[model samples]
Target: MAIWYTADTHFGHENIIPFSGRPFRSASHMDSALIENMWKVVKPEDTLWIVGDFAFGPAAKDMNWLEMIFGQLPGAEKHLVVGNHDGELSQLLPWDSVSQLTEVEDNGKCNVLCHYPMITWSGARKGALQIFGHVHNNWFGSRNAVNAGVDVWDYMPVTLADIERRARKLPINKHWTDVEQRTAAE
Candidate 1:
């Protein structure tokens, strides 16, 4: 089964549309599109990891509404790296796992997952990749730290290969040199 990752969905937050410059006309429209986009690539057998900010606004506070949205998530196993917006109700969803930070081994490579991007992470000096969200469209992330937010990734979950490919083309993080050994290229 493949592993998929995404973050900062802000599913029910109406204000996010205007604030983040999202293309949706309304929150409902954005939610539907996000779900559709996820199902397009994330199959039932794949594992889906949402780094943070699963939902927000009035809808998120309702147990039934949260359940409805949680039920619609397309994945055999869902994991949540709890974000600031992920309230107690969001955490109550039957997730496979939930935490503020965790390490995942995808394609034999270690990936440090968190709600917010970090200047340094576990295994940073050993080639581990850090995937995070929360900044939304303001940043696209650096070489070693990649943004997995939907706003930057066409509002869809991405695979590890996708993240790695993007990391290679992006500029290296300035703080990378401070935490890790300097490479000849840098």
Candidate 2:
């Protein structure tokens, strides 16, 4: 099965439209577009790792609606990594696999996946790639890391091989805290 990664969908959360400067006119529109974009690449046999923030605000509390949405989406092996918004979901949702961290090995390379961007993770110095979300695109990741959130990837899931290829093209992040401070000030 093909593998994919994405995070911070925030489905059914209306405030995200304006707060994140999303182009959608409403949450429903955003949700439709996100689903369409996701299914375009993700097939039934694929595996999609939703790193975190699958839903938020009102959406997170609506168990029935959330489950319906999951059912409607293409049937891929769905894995979850808990994020700040995903705290409630981690305990209740019935997913293929759910955790705060997951490790993946592809093309002889290992990737450490998580919801929040970390300064250091398992195998950081050994050249393992860190795939994360929660910062969107404001904070550039470390040399061996990359943001896997939809906001940085045209609002759709990205493949591991693609993430690896792109990470290799970026320059190393010299000061992690400095980048955090700059993004906060913006």
Candidate 3:
């Protein structure tokens, strides 16, 4: 079984438009494509790590729909690290429905898992790496971390090998370049 990490599916976000230029007119269109693509690469025994933003808005009535969609996914286990759009999900979701966020140290590597990216670079200094989602376009560098976001949602998912080699080099400092600061200020 392989371990996969992906985030920002935004399953029910009818407003979502892929950055890659693909067109999705409704949430159903996005949902079907996401699930089909995910299952195409996911084995029944594989584990999926969903970083955050599983849902679109702040309504608890949609829990049934959420569960139905997630239940249909093919995986041995699914873990969710809460994101900003988690909303009332934390309470309505069953205990077994989602995995709690925590720091993990495995195979001589340290990593922090969270929905929001932390500002500190403690993970790298401690010989750990942080895997996160949030900034969709910040997928560059070697040691820094950011989620691939739904805009670039790839059903194939990301492997640890890819994360280590690519995301590790991202800038760890909070000070953004003039371009970055301007984008954030917008």
Q: Which segments of model 1 are wrong by more than 4 Å?
A: 181-186
Candidate 2 structure quality by residue, lDDT tens digits, 1-186: 788888888888898777777889888899899899989999999888888888887766878878876765655688888888875654376788888898987667778989888777677757788899888657546677888887778898889888877888887767644533435544
**Candidate 1 residue-wise lDDT, 1-37, digit = tens:** 9999999998899999999999999999999999999
For all candidates, the clash counts are 0, 0, 10
Error of 3 at 116 (Å): 1.3
What is the Cα-based TM-score of model 2?
0.87
Question: Which residue ranges in model 3 land beyond 4 Å of their true spot?
Answer: 18-22, 58-60, 94-100, 105-108, 138-142, 153-155, 168-186
CA lDDT scores, all candidates in order: 0.95, 0.80, 0.63
The collision pairs in model 2 are none
| TM-score, candidate number 1 | 0.96
TM-score of each: 0.96, 0.87, 0.75
Model 2 poorest 10 in a row by lDDT? 176-185
